[model samples]
Target: MFEGHDPYLVALSVVIAILGGYTGFGLAARIRGTPGVSHRVLLAGAAGFLAVGIWTMHFIGMLAAPIPADTVYLVLPTIISFLICALVVGISLFFVSIGEPSLRRVISSAILLGVGIASMHYVGMHGLSGNFTMEHDDSMVLLSVLVAIVAAYGGLRAFLARQDGIRLIASSIAFGVAVSGMHYTAMFGGHFVPLSGEGHHHGVSGLAASQQILSIVVAVLCFVIAAGFLLSLVPEPRRRGARDSAGETGALAPETDAAAVDVVSPQRDHAGPAAPRIVSAPLGGLGQPQRPAPVARLPLEGADGTHFIDTANVRSVRADAHYTRVHDGTRERMCPWSISEAEAQLDPSLFVRVHRSHIVAIPHVSFVRKEGDGAVIELDGPSPHRVPVSRAKIAELKARLGLARPHA
Candidate 1:
């Protein structure tokens, strides 16, 4: 019934609708984690949207005036009303959900809802024939507070449930029930009189009326949808089972055993002798005839005739015409050979550029530290040294160390 109803009544209805809509919408949007919008930003926008939705609902419903004898049509419109209400409210709640719990968000939502309600009521009242001003009685205050509390609780529940799915559903249900209670309580707060004449003037049906029943259903659906969306927002924590097991083993193992394992890898490589080759006899002869004389093993050399230093072993590269000095950690350890000759003898990959002044073994890198002007590279040898990082070489150093994501 739209036309000829008191504007005050329409305003009251709008206010209630707005409050419900704001809270619902805020919770829904927040749990969804809409990017770039912070909690504060959501709250601000929801306040405006809820107010407008509420005002629009009241004004439009008033325009529809009284429906003559077509109660069935009311159901369709009322459903539409509820749908609109749910969407507006859901978005408002969503906004409130992502932000920090604050009086600001709560008060903002409440005030907007209240303003919508008040504005609608007054506007509708202006259209009424009676000379009356809507003065908020004790009932109005109680109703407003009730709406505020329920909406606030709903917003809170949505946020809590977002972290756990089960919790999210539970919170949604709780919020829906709370909202239903608030709606019924507010509807009953209205003051109206009915005519005794047959099929004459009458007031709203009892709380159990079909219209109210439908409202409850709509409210429940709103809660459910909001809860589901919120649950989707939280990310599941990752599992580190393998790493954890490895850590446990390392922690429990003796230090000497760990060291023994470390020493085994290097020794296996250099200590093993080359496999001996069997020579066949003239006639499948003599059970795999005696092996031939071993050929002289040429020295392993790097590109610049540089030899790898396994300091643990006392074997040193010969000081020959090709290379003049033995380079170690302390001195430049002069060598007559060029870089290319040294690289030819050594594994090029193992020895990499650390800085302009040094070429270090990859296995020797312990860590890379960022210093003010340059990076300080630490080596893992028995004796460690900090090498300076030239600005020109920082990018290369970082790439080699895998300290950062690849820039190119």
Candidate 2:
């Protein structure tokens, strides 16, 4: 069976797999910390590209095989195989994406995706119809599944890492090689026997046969994957603007990029400025030392619509990627604020930055306990939320909590 294989097609199949893996995993990595429509869109796009890549690579590898000349592909099973790959791949990605990812979640997701890859391959193999009986070496089949799972775990781990261009490309190449290896491994384990009669081949109606069709299908899918990969390479527009390190709750104007603030000043009141004129300097220098009111309510996006949670109700704000998540006694919501923004804008008297990623409302602290070099703060909330305090900030946090022991 190996003798008739086209080495060039096999190489091309592997290339396709690598490209797909690169595009898919790269897209999935971006889903972290992003929320709402953007998050959902990225997940879907990642899954789609990954699935297409896997499916395309499998069929192309099949085309490279030394198979019976009269073989025809079944429509239903082929479609089913693709769908199975897509559904399982999507589920696996989502599994690792939600909440805080742990070792168990990553492994479980990898196992699932690996099994799915094996299933798709075998099912696609089963779709083959010709004047032959197929038999597989059970051990080789199992080995292929094992390879799939291990490779999947590696791909997911690479994604979990803080990806730079070099790592992303390297991981993609590794995954592509593993995926292609699984395909050929499974193929080599199976042998087909030609029957004395071609009756079975003739009866195989409602199916398509010919190397031409396979080539066309692979080409079209490759085109789609290439388009998606190129699109993913394009950078997304920056959603937020830069602000001073000092916490300021600045809102953008209705139709412009200029931040607008309502100011009441006596000197400027010779004719109170109505329209938001661009302040050349900080607002404090305009003879109005009174700063804008502290951020009283945190804006959050929920399934229904945008909602505001009173700062008084917020127990903690934890940084998630570029955004922050607010724990408000009852539940957690994603906020548009960065950790620095949250620390700066929140009232200093009520909220304090306990760690680079954490902002805790002092009034909500229920307990404090030391853990190794750092300490843990248990906030009073509907759900038990623990915020880690950096060793450097322990003293300040304790002072604000009134647990600081007086100097000797």
Candidate 3:
């Protein structure tokens, strides 16, 4: 029966479950669609919040159980359980954050997480000390593990989908249920028997229920607060000018007036048949000045040789740390220049920077598809490729492609 259950501690466990679930899902969302060091740091913080929350909940639940007067928890095993939980959850999040998602990776992450949860539970149980022996129902243990696996998979899928705020909150509730259900069900399956003896000496001094509860609550609160602060540091997307804003489309913006054309005229020198001097003038009376043809030669140098590539043949230019990778329809070559530098040199009418890391040729882009908070540009060639569009750049890209007018 639930003889020793403290309603207050039980309520605290439920609160911990809810907070933990929300923090876990929030971490997953922050980690997705992000790259480099920021992704890694956010993933670590999220894993820490989840693992510590689970461990705290388990220990708090144990403290709520009715036990013999001599019962105590060994310090080392309890500490080990917490470490195991953190390590396992951290590994699972890391696997999910890198590259494209796949079923095999999801299953693998789930198994690792499930095993970690079961191990933490059993190890914590082993930490119990008294003149008593513990036994567990094999069927119940199997069932708990199965629940862990299913719950882990479901949570991962929901978080990875990067749904809206309401869906994320709902998934968090489901996650909380999964975690709490597994814990209480496992507890129900366990039986503790007092040894047949007159008296027993308890060597280890365990904290009183109140002290344990207070310490765990404070620690978990600190962890949650720290995670929240870190997540807040993630930068918001840059704000773009309205589509109707002047100069939004770079060179693609329509001409409002005839551009002044520079025309050179030869002047006869007054002194003794000197070579004719040249003077320049702006030809405003002429019809709209002819637009210059798009620049054709892209000066690039690689290990093989320095050459001028026809800009029309360039499919994309990707920023690669200190250098840029210039991709043609058939192959890619590394140039010593940065992407921004190349962007300045390229014809704005033919190419546009779609993301911080990428610039695509307008002619090569076949279509654009929205995904999550961003969009992807599909390029047409022998081998089609997709390039990510930054949230801030989406409007600008549309304007460049003549798909939408600039908005305020």
How high a TM-score does candidate 1 get? 0.31
> Between 2 and 3, whose TM-score is larger?
2
lDDT of 1 by residue, 158-253 (tens): 543322345444554554444433433433443323334556633333222233343454345434434434453545343333433432333233
Question: Residue 52 lDDT in model 2?
Answer: 95
Off by over 4 Å in 2: 197-202, 238-335, 338-408
Question: Global lDDT of each model?
Answer: 0.40, 0.77, 0.67
Error of 3 at 169 (Å): 0.7
Cα-based TM-score, every candidate: 0.31, 0.63, 0.57
Highest TM-score scorer: 2
- Kindly indicate the candidate among 1 and 3 with the higher lDDT: 3
Instruction: For each candidate in turn, give its C-alpha RMSD to the true structure in angstroms.
Output: 23.8, 10.1, 12.2
> For residues 277-370, what per-residue lDDT tens digits would candidate 2 score against the true structure?
2122354545432334577788775434457888999999986555678888754667766665565457777887777668899999999999
Worst 10 residues of 3 by lDDT: 263-272
Residue 213 lDDT, candidate 3, scale 0-100: 46
- What's the residue-level lDDT of 365 in candidate 1? 65
- lDDT value for model 3: 0.67
